[model samples]
Target: STRMRFGRGAASPAGVLRAIASGGGTDAFRLDGVDHRDDAGRLEVLATEDLAVEQIGYADVVVLSRADACSPEALRRAEERVAVQNGAAAIASAARGEMRGPSTLEALLGLRRADFVQTTPAKATHHHAYESVSLTLDGEVDGERFADFVETEVARFSGRLLRTKGILAVAGLEQRMIVQGVADLVEITFGEPWGDAKRTSRVAIVGFGLDVGSLERAFTTCAAS
Candidate 1:
């Protein structure tokens, strides 16, 4: 049998660092609360947060909370900022601490084990100017078309697209499609069925200085015809 231990902390990296150095091997590092800070004092707070992220050296994932209170544009911008600072981390959005399902768990813990011995300390990058956007569709989308759209858009926005994810209703599929992208890497997987519940599409995009209206319109075009 394999043994695993997990640890968490608030506004501090010491505990997490100690956990990583204990030789148990870290499965992942998650930075929560990416959307809760205000712009007025965000610079100082973001600086502290970036330092903590760098100290940890690597984060496998980032979670954005209080997403419901923010506009899609705000969410997208936040994702972009996080991407710029932690380019390798996957970003997920949560509302009132609730994530989608097993997919979130898989994303948080499914990565290759951290090899601290060969890992180099990360250098801090300033991320004060990032922005994001979110979109919600009340209908099903053509799966093939959506896939093509995502691939093209991610490539086109490679430099600015920090993170993108969607829980979608595919026109011919019963199972929900969960789409996630970090920079140019895109992952699409089938999730649990919608069962008797209402089917809808929800997507959030995080990027740098994105044209929110234009992106929203483009996404809307991917709906089934």
Candidate 2:
């Protein structure tokens, strides 16, 4: 950037325009990127600062990444902030290598999430400093208690919790309960039937500085007792 006469730490205007331009096509999605950590809250895309706001303003989506890093209130504020600049664009939250809300990969790819079979994600080859906990249960869980746990205790640790996704075997529900959460925001939906598959409940939590024992204990307590 220095050699090109742009600010020392800032992106080149031509580069930003060229990159955003490359995303154009009838089938393409114009995404205005921001992070809930700072950029979203500030409603600023430093990389595109020098470029005309109109150049990047025409977007089909506003991607707010790292939403798990912020509180529910913070996320709400970030959305409002982003909307000030890109009010027409749909908002999407991304976390834990998967989209947490609408505008997911499948949606972008023109596919329905329910059309695919849910499977355990393959183990990653690399590891980061964050801690991950996986628990399995052969018995059914108490749906109400699990929902309360997600709304309360689990949400209380949002700052350090990156993601919590699981296949829940609810005591009376015949179909599997699929849950995915980031911070205090969680989405739960009924999935396909167990069929011939074993009735097992598996929950995985990924985060930084997580108290494994406490989380696991509290999690198990949601069992139908």
Candidate 3:
């Protein structure tokens, strides 16, 4: 599992990293408030609570990006603020466009398995920023059908959909599948074996102005018939 990173500015701190971490099927476990970012590069007016607000005090790690855009003083000030806000969070800074290359991305998300583990629970705030729907299915699902379902939803949601991710229990594969998406982009790969974890498939869709009832119904049909 790659180390999940949350963007700054309007996007709340990565309270959702714990969920991604636990999805790795490791022996570790912890639940966190999810704050999936809205569409990348999209700007919007935020409420007072959504602006420069530190809702949680115990974030595991915080990645400071766009270092090239800020001077030494500005960067230092941002770091200082993070320290004051999430004192326990490990601070990592990245130069502009540093995350563009595939190799660079691998390094960022390839953090140690333990880094993703959270010791305390954080609640997700700022509901106005985005909406999310979680779906879990028992037994195996048809991989092809699941892919089709994702494609259909992404298209239907269009500019409103932000991301989709979770573990899947495929019809015949004992190894769990990791599903991830950003906008219309989606990918699936083999992960650790089911091991002692339940043989259940779970996924989540984060978007803006979603038709929850229709999405939930469409996703359920991905099950093997």
By TM-score, the best candidate is 1
Model 3: per-residue Cα lDDT over 5-43, one tens digit each? 887545433334434543566656633322211111121
Sorted on lDDT, best first, the list reads 1, 2, 3
Candidate 1 segments whose C-alpha is farther than 4 A from its true place: 1-127
Per-residue CA lDDT of model 2 for 114-208, tens digit only, reads 22222332222222334445666677899898878777767767656544557778988889887654433456778788777777776766555
Candidates in order, TM-scores: namely 0.50, 0.46, 0.49
Q: Give the TM-score of candidate 2.
A: 0.46
lDDT value, candidate 2, whole model: 0.53
User: How much lDDT does candidate 3 score?
Assistant: 0.52
* Candidate 3: stretches off by over 4 Å: 1-129
Cα RMSDs of all predictions?
A: 13.3, 15.9, 14.7
lDDT of 1 by residue, 62-162 (tens): 56667777777877776655555544345566676676332556555432111101112122235434444566677898877777767665456766655
Q: What is the lDDT of residue 37 in candidate 3?
A: 19
Better of 2 and 3 by TM-score: 3
Return the lDDT, model 1, position 77: 72
Question: Which lDDT values do the candidates have, in the order given?
Answer: 0.55, 0.53, 0.52
